[model samples]
Target: MDPFAPPPFGAPADLGEPDPRDRPARLAVGVVGAGRVGTALGEALDRAGHRVVAASAVSEQSRRRAAERLPDAALTSPQEVVAAADLVLLTVPDDALAELAGGLVATGADVAGKLVAHTSGRYGTAVLNPLTRAGGLPLALHPVMTFTGRPDDTGRLSGVSFGVTAPDPLRPVAEALVLEMGGEPVWIAEDRRALYHAALAGGANHLVTLVVEAMDLLRAAGVGEPGRMLGPLLGASLDNALRLGLDGLTGPVARGDAGTVADHVAELARVSPEGLRAYVALARLTADRALAAGLLKPEDAERLLEVLAD
Candidate 1:
């Protein structure tokens, strides 16, 4: 049960020349759900010299995709994929993962001696309970990167952080797989999986919402090309926030400009009522953060809050 020890399930028999990271011999890898994540990870592992034993997708579109990514890998049902490979990656939609696990276990697909992992960020090892009960090691290793349905997704695998959650018996294998995929592994407790996913959603998904709202505002103001004007500023602001921490925050909220805040809310209410609530909510949150950062005095923060609340 040593967290750093490799699992007994997927160890290769020959133990040939060690990989660059001195990992245990490459395991036969199988991928289920040949969507973007599955295809990308399969191709990256294949490129890293792992044996891609099998890959399967529920639809013809997914099968074609897996074929394009790993032409030599067998295409079969999910149960076949699980039975054929030493390590099975369930990359199906989060909602479908539990059912898939149950199906794999019901079919008696050698779960007892396999390493089972999933790309779902929401549920941890618990979603693979059927596999776990059958003695398969369950791991959640979600890559913190966006996936586009393109053959070149392998490139995006490099330099990403993978949120890894697994039992102590399976941690090393999960970490090694992350390394094999050119990603750094960040260990997370299984119980915190939902909270971790929520954080990611708030940051990545809501950032898109904020940007789209900005674009809409710009368009309403008659800007012909808002993206061109906003791109550099957005990039620089992100860079500064990352490098300088909270001290890098700028804008009316950071400056505690209550008048400007009121003006923005008023303008949005008049011109874009649909965006008003989001703008106010986000502004209030930013104001609180600004207050905590010492960028806004208490009185100014209070006034800004009042303006945003209105």
Candidate 2:
């Protein structure tokens, strides 16, 4: 079978994911905020055979991005974007989403019977209450991937998980849209949206901080190419952690080596006083996990706890 061949409509593919051909009929897509995410999704949908009719871009950077990704889409105001498309993507920041929706309604945007989807991870369909009240179909479809507005951003959408939350009757529509965009839909309840977003932020966002701190330390220790050195080690550690959870831990804290951990704490305090607090906190959490997982003996954990406390 040709990997790129289109799947038969209404038939499950080899991976059992939703078939891309099973999506709704082609519709005119509109992007309300032509930021990195908005343009990327718009481009992906365009690749899936939907027409990008119009896009709203306030900043020069956003306008440039929309030009590159949705070249055929007319640059217009937010109200005009909503008025021209069958599906409107609200890609604004999380805090500004509700206000944007309210403003669109107040400005007399024609949203009735249109599919209004927001790309906010923190919110569900509830944030689009204004649009819904105006007879719009609301969908909360958040792609679980970072976007830098580069040419590669749209390509990254393939097979990425989308946190989807919609009314029970609209679940299929929500999932179908994700499938069309080359994303897998993971159904998220409205109440669990915050928790789901928090988990992603804690893991992916905090991991960046931790890795950058490690690079800074490596440079201080005279390593010229920190990324080259950390690349393999971090890659393996991430793989192990994903495959084994707590069992993948192998550092001094996981091994209950209080002396080594104490040395680390002392060195951090002396060399990088600002990083000492985060080190201590993460070390304590690691030790607790190791102990609970039975990887560290009770006697050994007591020494580790004392060092952490100090």
Candidate 3:
């Protein structure tokens, strides 16, 4: 099976035997922040037989998203939403999560005995200590897919991997909720959540920058429809990297062609000086990986590294 291939739509995640800590099959769910992630997950939960009873939406855009995707859920205040549901999803921005949890507790919200989960890849359950102190069962469930808040957002939930962090007693509950939403739960330890999120950002977020830069360079060189030219190449490169790791590397740096790499650096610096730094940095890293992977000999890597440094 290709690791890059998405799972079949509606495929069930293998959760093995059910555990005692698992909640009832149907839950009254509330969303504390009706952002893209919140509404999408709320809709997915509704499709999974859960009742989306309430959701808090401050912005007009968020309120519209909640109305469109989570039609059954009433738009209310965060405190009211928490008070009305068995499970509450706090899908605020990463920086806002701790404050939201803390504020919920500060306002004397009825979080006691309720399952409260936040969708922040950079955080673990520890960030919800404020709510935990108030007797709320805190869990972190960060979905590994990007959300655009479009109608198709709910479909993206199918077969997605959710980074989950929960206490031992609530592990079953976390996995069950992920499975119910058609996502595979990948358990992440508390101490490693930040690193895990960083890896994701480095890959997905930076790939966009790299691709856009490439497209810009191509357009500058008078290549019309840059996407058409890059689509197959990028697709194959991604698949190769997934399958072969560093051994999949190609191009001048990977082959230790110092002259070609030097020419690339010279041309970019001449025409697109702003992108020169990133190109050099990535080339240096690629040369290191290729050298370590035995794809480039030490003699060739020495020359390659010299070109990048220059």
User: What's the TM-score of every candidate structure?
Assistant: 0.91, 0.92, 0.92
Model 1, span 1-310: residue lDDT tens: 5322443433333346555213456677899888999999988877666778898887878888888888878998888888888788899898998899898878878877678889999988889988888878788999999898786688998999999999876777788788878899999888899999999989899899889989989998999999999999999999998899888889998888999888988899998898899888878888888888788899999999988766
Query: Across residues 105-162, which tens digit of lDDT does each residue of candidate 3 receive?
Result: 9999988778999999999999999888888888899999998878998899899999
Ranking by lDDT: 2, 3, 1
Error of 3 at 120 (Å): 0.3
Candidate 2 regions exceeding 4 Å error are 1-24
lDDT of each residue in 114-229, candidate 2, tens digit only: 88999999999999998888878889999999998789998999999999999876777788789978999999999999999999999999999999999999999999999999
Residue 32, model 1, lDDT:
87
- Clashing residue pairs, backbone N/CA/C < 3 A, model 1: none
The clash count of every prediction, one per candidate, is 0, 0, 0
| Superposition error at 209 for model 3 (Å) | 0.6
**What is the C-alpha local distance difference test score of each model?**
0.84, 0.88, 0.88
Question: Local error of candidate 2 at 20, Å?
Answer: 12
Error of 3 at 295 (Å): 1.0
